[model samples]
Structures are given as C-alpha cells and as structure tokens.
Target chain A: MYLAKIYVTYKPSILDPKGETVKDALHRLDYQAVSDVVMGKYFEIKIANDNESDVRKMVEAFSQQLLINVNMEVFRYELIALSTAV
Target chain B: MYLAKIYVTYKPSILDPKGETVKDALHRLDYQAVSDVVMGKYFEIKIANDNESDVRKMVEAFSQQLLINVNMEVFRYELIALSTAV
Candidate 1:
C-alpha cells in the first residue's frame, strides 16, 4: 500500500477567521511571538496499490479534482510507502 | 510583506486517532467517499519585510525550530507576495 498526505489552505488574499482566533489565543497565552495564523485541512489517502508512481498519480488527480478549491485555496501532497517491515 | 503557508502532518507509521474519528464522522454524515482524515496544524507567518529570499529563510528556520516535529511529522511551505496593487 501507499500513503498519501494532503494539505489544503486558503489563498493569501483571503482572510482566515479560524487562524485569527488561534492567533489571539496564543497571544493571550503569552506566545506573543506569533504574529498570524491560517488554518487548513489535512487528509491521508491510503492507496491499496503499492506502486509509488501509481500512488503519486492518484494523489495528484485527487487533489486536483476534490481535495482543493483552486478559487480559494491550494494543495500539495506527498507519497510514502506503507510499510518497511519483513 | 511575505505570506508563508505552512502545513504539518503526522508520519504515516504513526496511528492517527484524530483521522479515524473524522473518518467515522464523515461516514456518519453519509460522505462515504472519504476514507480517512488526518489532522494537522496550518500557519501563515507574515513577515514585515518583503524580501522574498529573507522571508523564505525565516520560514525555513521557523519550521525547523518550532513549527514541526521531525520525529512525528513533516511540513512544507510556500511563499506568496502580500500585495500587488499599485
């Protein structure tokens, strides 16, 4: 099997309310060094097939088709082997 | 200013309870297409300085030092210009 890690986030031009809330909380907690925060979604897609190339293709297609909203966000992903055990 | 979008996710070998919970939620919500959901932290670090190279360096350093745990997670980022209006 192959493991696909995907990340999706809002475009720079849009305001992120959730991130702002977290930023405020962090500041309140004395983490003043943090200036801003933007929140995003993460997903792991497990492909039953073990071929790295095939997994990459599937993840690329999935991200482009369903994982991200290009009008508001961008996404990227990585593929890794599911197991290295004997 | 520069916009730094960072994404962090758990390593594949690690068991992700959060992801499983989300998967269950989706299933309950009738979104059967979703097989899994892995949660992660996302941040947008705004740099006061607009130098792209400097911002990239700062983000890289920040991610390595405070943003992600190399043992349990991986992260990646992208840089975008904050403004283009004249």
Candidate 2:
C-alpha cells in the first residue's frame, strides 16, 4: 500500500476572499502584525499498489481529473509507502 | 516577524467536487489505483512582530474572522519566527 499526499492551492494572482477575510480578522484581533493570510487544501490518499511508476501515473491522472481546477488551482503530490518495514 | 501557516480543509462529510473530478480523471488516465481525491487550501501569513503571545492572539482572531468559514471549512495554524539568527 502507498500513501499519496496532495497539496492544492489557488493561483497566486487570484483573489481569495477567504484569505482576505482571515487577514482582516487577524488585524482586528490585535495581531496587527499579521499582514496576510492565504488558504489552500491538502489531501492524503491511500492506494493499494506496489509499482512506483504506476502510482505516479495514477497521481498524474488524478491531478488532471478531479484533484484540481486547472483554471483556478494547482496541485502537487508525494507518494510514500505505508509499510516502512524496510 | 513570524510566519503563520494555516491549513484549510473541507469537512469529511462535505462533498468536494474538485476532488471527485480529480479521481475520475485519474481513473481515465489509467491510474485506476487511485480511488479518491479531496482538495483544500493552505495559507501562509507573514507577520511583522516578535511577541509570541500577541501573534497567537492575532492568529486566533484571524481564524475566527476571515481564515475559516466556521461553517463549511476548518483551519489550524502555527507561528514560526523569520529570524532564527539566535
């Protein structure tokens, strides 16, 4: 089995209202030291496969499919073995 | 200055269409090993302060305000110093 960790994020240039709101809140919360806040998503997926090449193919396909919005978001991932018994 | 890293994620019960789409894409891409994909957001905030207590207060307020939906999303954060010259 393998573990795939994916990090999803909004394009830097895009305006993230969620992030803006958090930054504003920080400022008001007396943390005027905080100037910015941006938010993104992270996912950890488990797969039952042993082939590294196959897993990469899987993650690449996953990214292209449902994992990301090419228009607004970008994604990156890392795959690790579940059994570090080695 | 400090760095606030906020990780935002969709509640498990919530349906992430983006994640679904990525999963579907992975299947079609011949990575059938991939069964699911869930996406979320990550925000990194840079604060201009050295007071740890003040920074925590700021992040807590930010999370309550614009950092998290409190309804649809959840967030967690950590603060690290920018200058480790010590």
Q: Of the candidates shown, which would achieve the greatest TM-score relative to the real structure?
A: 2
Local accuracy of candidate 1 as per-residue lDDT tens digits, A42-66: 7776656666786676667656765
| Model 2 interface Cα RMSD in Å | 2.6
Poorest lDDT segment (10 consecutive residues) of candidate 2 chain B: B32-41
lDDT of 1 at A38: 74
Model 1's CAPRI class?
acceptable
Instruction: Report residue A21 deviation for candidate 1 (angstroms).
Output: 9.8
RMSD of 1: 6.7
User: What's model 2's lDDT at A4?
Assistant: 87
Quantify all predictions' global Cα lDDT against the true fold.
0.72, 0.74
**What is candidate 1's CA lDDT for residue A77?**
81
Model 1 steric clash pairs = none
Candidate 2 segments whose C-alpha is farther than 4 A from its true place: A8-31, A39-41, A51-80, A83-86, B84-86
Ten contiguous residues minimizing lDDT sum, candidate 1 chain A? A25-34
Cα-based lDDT at residue A63, candidate 2: 64
